[model samples]
Target: MKILTAVCVMALLVIASAAWADAPKRVKFTWSGGEAVAELNGSPSAESLWAMLPVTVDFKDFNGVERIAYTEKELSAEGAPESCTPDAGTLALYAPWGNLSVFYKPFRESRGLVPLGRFVEGADKVSTLGEAVRIERME
Candidate 1:
């Protein structure tokens, strides 16, 4: 019985883990400066947040005027975050003159339903809410 239980558990983990491995990665790109901390939290639980997913699209060069096709890649338990909490990744469709800025922050006190595809995930490249995790965003 114990062996059967162990096998089942291991099987479940294998199944769950494999599903996430195929998912699109949350690409984070951080540069050297920012003066504020941002978030996405509308609720109070610590479980509801993503901190500082980064991007590199030279927002300063645009003089802060641009538009973008933003998106959110919804994830699941199979894609259990490194924090073991569920979360989603954001993708901004922008270039220097066309794309505005990028910002990934924790879910904070006043977050709203902010759109996903046709809407805005509100990733402001101005918030440095969390410590930077080293990563390479392949263009």
Candidate 2:
């Protein structure tokens, strides 16, 4: 009976995990010459970002590694894990500066950087994007 109970619990866990994975939060960004599609993670920071979507910002190249932009609103970072070695096409928030970071290149992990999402398509174009861009929810 104990073994059966454990199996049932595991099965429930798997179903829950699968349900979570199936829920998608897609976003998109468009600039003069580039566009990208991304999916936001189910994090508080990501949720905050989503709330402020359909915003326009002027993105600038930072450290030759990523495009950076600043938003007027500050996002909550409570319970966010330390970030490290962000993969290309990653979207993150730099808490200290309250700036948004869209990584075009891999970077070593750093504190105060909270992951927000990842690109699902057109990631390659992000590295070359510049000037004013519009970000909005795709779905």
Candidate 3:
């Protein structure tokens, strides 16, 4: 009985891990300085952004802590959390203004900010991206 139980547990774990591994990657943002890849969360807003991939936009520094870009189209904020506290490399959508925000420094919790994802690489270069940035889906 013990052997059978262990085998079942191990099989379940393998299946779960396989499913996770097969999940689709999110997006990558590139600029003159460097590139960063973000692993998006399972949120409506994130999905909306994903649908508009391979876009180019201009980014500007904001509050000395992050970069802000106008997405032209507003993302869905339904089912998003009421508030979010951003840290370095955090990516989010500012619902009120319908802009995309990428943090390079920690900030206070605020409402109407929808969590998107975080930079998995080259986060340090986020603060140095050129005015023009290209975002595309990662395979």
Candidate 4:
């Protein structure tokens, strides 16, 4: 049946496309506002100046002593770039000069806190304002 063959092929294509869409997209972590600019491909070589894990990163109203206010042990239904996956075991870190958050893959554990990701605040996808690096990766 010609129609059946065409339908099968279309179904296969749809499945393939779905798989492709679910795959992670490689992206360089945006830590430009922090002291360390690192890439978040889950590579071992990335470096961070000020951030860590087993904690939640909170951004205060631009801080001189912006204390960490919360700890997000689990992030659910959160939108992430292709390179990031929010799992219960996802490790967190940051750059030293700023509150840059990094989500590392399995290999990056205990590597002296390297940065593999970051989150920015406000409407600007990229925030560059004042003495503060508005971009910070929380715990």
Q: Itemize residue pairs with steric clashes in candidate 3.
A: none
- Compared with the true structure, all predictions reach lDDT values of 0.31, 0.88, 0.89, 0.33
User: By summed lDDT, which 10 consecutive residues of candidate 3 come out lowest?
Assistant: 20-29
Candidate 2: list runs displaced more than 4 Å. 1-22
lDDT score for candidate 2 against the true structure: 0.88
Rank by TM-score (best first): 3, 2, 1, 4
- Across 1-139, the per-residue lDDT of candidate 4 in tens digits comes to 9999999999999999998655432222232343332223333322222223322234332232112222233222122232333222222333222233332223323322333333322213222322323333332
Model 3 C-alpha lDDT versus the unseen true structure: 0.89
- Which scores greater on TM-score, model 1 or model 2? 2
The positional error of residue 111 in candidate 2, measured at the CA in angstroms, is 1.0
Candidate 2 to truth, TM:
0.82
Please list the residue runs of candidate 1 whose C-alpha ends up more than 4 Å from where it truly belongs after superposition.
22-24, 35-60, 66-122, 126-139
Q: Is candidate 2 or candidate 4 better by lDDT?
A: 2
Error of 2 at 100 (Å): 0.5
Residue-level lDDT tens digits of model 1 in 20-55:
654333333344653322232222221111322343
Candidate 1, residue 78: the lDDT equals: 26
RMSD (Cα, Å) of candidate 1?
Answer: 12.5
Candidate 3 Cα outliers beyond 4 Å, as residue runs = 1-24
